[model samples]
Target: MRHFLRPTVALLFAALALLTHRAHPAEHAVVITTTSTLGAAAQAVGGDSVSVETILPPGSCPGHFDLEPAQVRRLLACELFLRHDFQSFLDGRLLANGVARDRIAALPAAGGLCVPDTFVALGRAAAEALAVRLPGETEALRTRAEALAHEAQTRGNTLLARTARLRGKPVAGALHQAAFLRWLGLDVRCVLPGGDDPTPGAVSRALTEIRATGALAIVGNVPSGRRLPSTLASRGPPLVMFDNFPPSPRACRLLGHARPQRRPPARRAPRIAPCRTRSSPSPTSPSATPAGHCWTTSRLRSHAAVSPPCSAPTAPVRPHCCACSTANSHPPPAPAVSSAPIRPHSTGAAARRGVAESA
Candidate 1:
């Protein structure tokens, strides 16, 4: 009887331990995300209630993300998966990998939750899903988020106002960014030549027009690579960099509530030195000047006479007279001049140039 009693007590203890383990299951929920940006948002919302796992690392191209087998399994085991509808890589893969629709949460539709508002709401929802109660102090967090949203709106307005000063001015950049700037009231002349990166030639041509028309700004995604913005900045006008992701605190702070940099007044190129010819009576004299110091054939012709009636010793003779003299003087060599008309390339021409012009 004593031996049976000892074995029974041991069995009872083992059963009690099993029951205790079952009663106190793990407290943390698992959250799976395709990118760190989304993972950060999930963590913000989940707070201490959930652990986040990002399948893609920072700075990785979101378009071509591929999940590992282990990551897929981990995702399947997670309590929830947060996804962005526009995320091509993650959304399709998750569905194909057999993740149930019910276990996923799509972000609020566009226009519903923007910037800081989206972040706060997502955080609250994640906490609620885990049955985690926020402390009374959470009211302060809510207040802060509201303040941030107001500040963002104010900043956006300020940016728009500055941009307004250059109303009707042409702008060009990434397609999505162009649309955003357009929404802010900018006249987007065109998108950068390629879908993402513009070729060197395309950039050169675009910059030429942008400079010619005096574009108000050249906007692009900051994370797209600094080369584009750096290139644009060096060329002319100011580059108004925009973040592709919804504004985060970091982004908001970077953009700030300050008004956009005032569009520096356009600087006109200095007039070229008037062309002079040796055939003229006073070869050192200035050539015929056209409107605003521009040299034209008509103005040059007006200045042609080599004799004294041309009056001013400093006045230049007509360009045609100089050309005629040159033709007679040097018959062997004709000055080569291109007959091509100066016209802005059509969109199709620019597109073709874009391919050949890639940096």
Candidate 2:
């Protein structure tokens, strides 16, 4: 009886320890992301057990965000950290700042889990990692997530439908939101050239090409410099801006509209002409006479011997010294002058004179 009692008491103690380990709150101190999407999922699974904080504020660009020292201190106190794969900037920073690898749970790698799907998967993973069953709210959170996904899909479909009406039209976007635009079946014309905040020259060139190709719209991601859209707006096409990471409800609203906002034309600088030079004709020119004879001081000097008698003008004696004599003898009714400068070597007298003398 003593031996049986000892074995029974040992088994009871072991069982109690297991239950305490499972139910202990600090044993699973979780740091879900501060970003609302992931934070919501953590809450879905953690229920009343875990603490979460989003590292960034609303409307901040995740990629360019910097971490606060207080957030780092909070991260050090956490027992478990869950992050969305490939999208959590804070997760990368935390890991780089000496967070243990095993303490983190990366979401499953599969398509179709864009946002809401991700939230559901995260809840399941977090519950499993903590070695505890999720509270009753797990099913409710899943149902809510599914409903949100359905709503997103419906909105996505509506945008796709509107885009389908205009086939083969070009569209433009900043780098981060290029995929979203392509997913909607719009032809991305030119990527916003160089740097997160595109330069005015780059924007101008892109808009010029877009206008030339008659692109239907310009799409940009949020957290981007306002200058990009403002610059685009001054040009012809309307712009549609979307969110990059942790997409917002406003993105849905913008997607539904699909129509570009009207903006005043961008002011452009005036173009200037290149510098050049021009030469003027000589002051002593030829004068018309009876019988249609004309003589200039330069022409007369070159052909002193064969000059037509200024009075008789007998067929304007062909000036033997220059090729101009032929045109003089058979002058056209109306002569046209070319703007091209006549070179000294190309003159009729220069050609007729002895080569050595001319040179």
Q: Give the TM-score of candidate 2.
A: 0.48
TM-scores of all predicted structures:
0.47, 0.48
lDDT of 2 by residue, 156-195 (tens): 3443453464445577666654554455455777666534
For every candidate, C-alpha RMSD to the true structure in Å: 24.1, 35.5
Residue runs of model 1 more than 4 Å from their true location after superposition: 1-26, 88-92, 95-98, 108-114, 118-173, 176-194, 226-229, 238-359
Candidate 2: C-alpha lDDT: 0.40
After superposition of all CA atoms, the RMSD between model 1 and the true structure is 24.1
lDDT tens readout by residue for model 1, 1-359: 99999999999999999987654333346767654345544544343445656553222334444466666667677777766556645656777899876677655424322233343454445444434223432553344334433443444444345345545557665553454445445577756544344568767877887777656556544335435655765776555433333211112112221111111124523211122222211101111100001111211111110111111122222221111011112121111111221122222344324322321
* 340 Cα displacement, candidate 1 (Å): 57
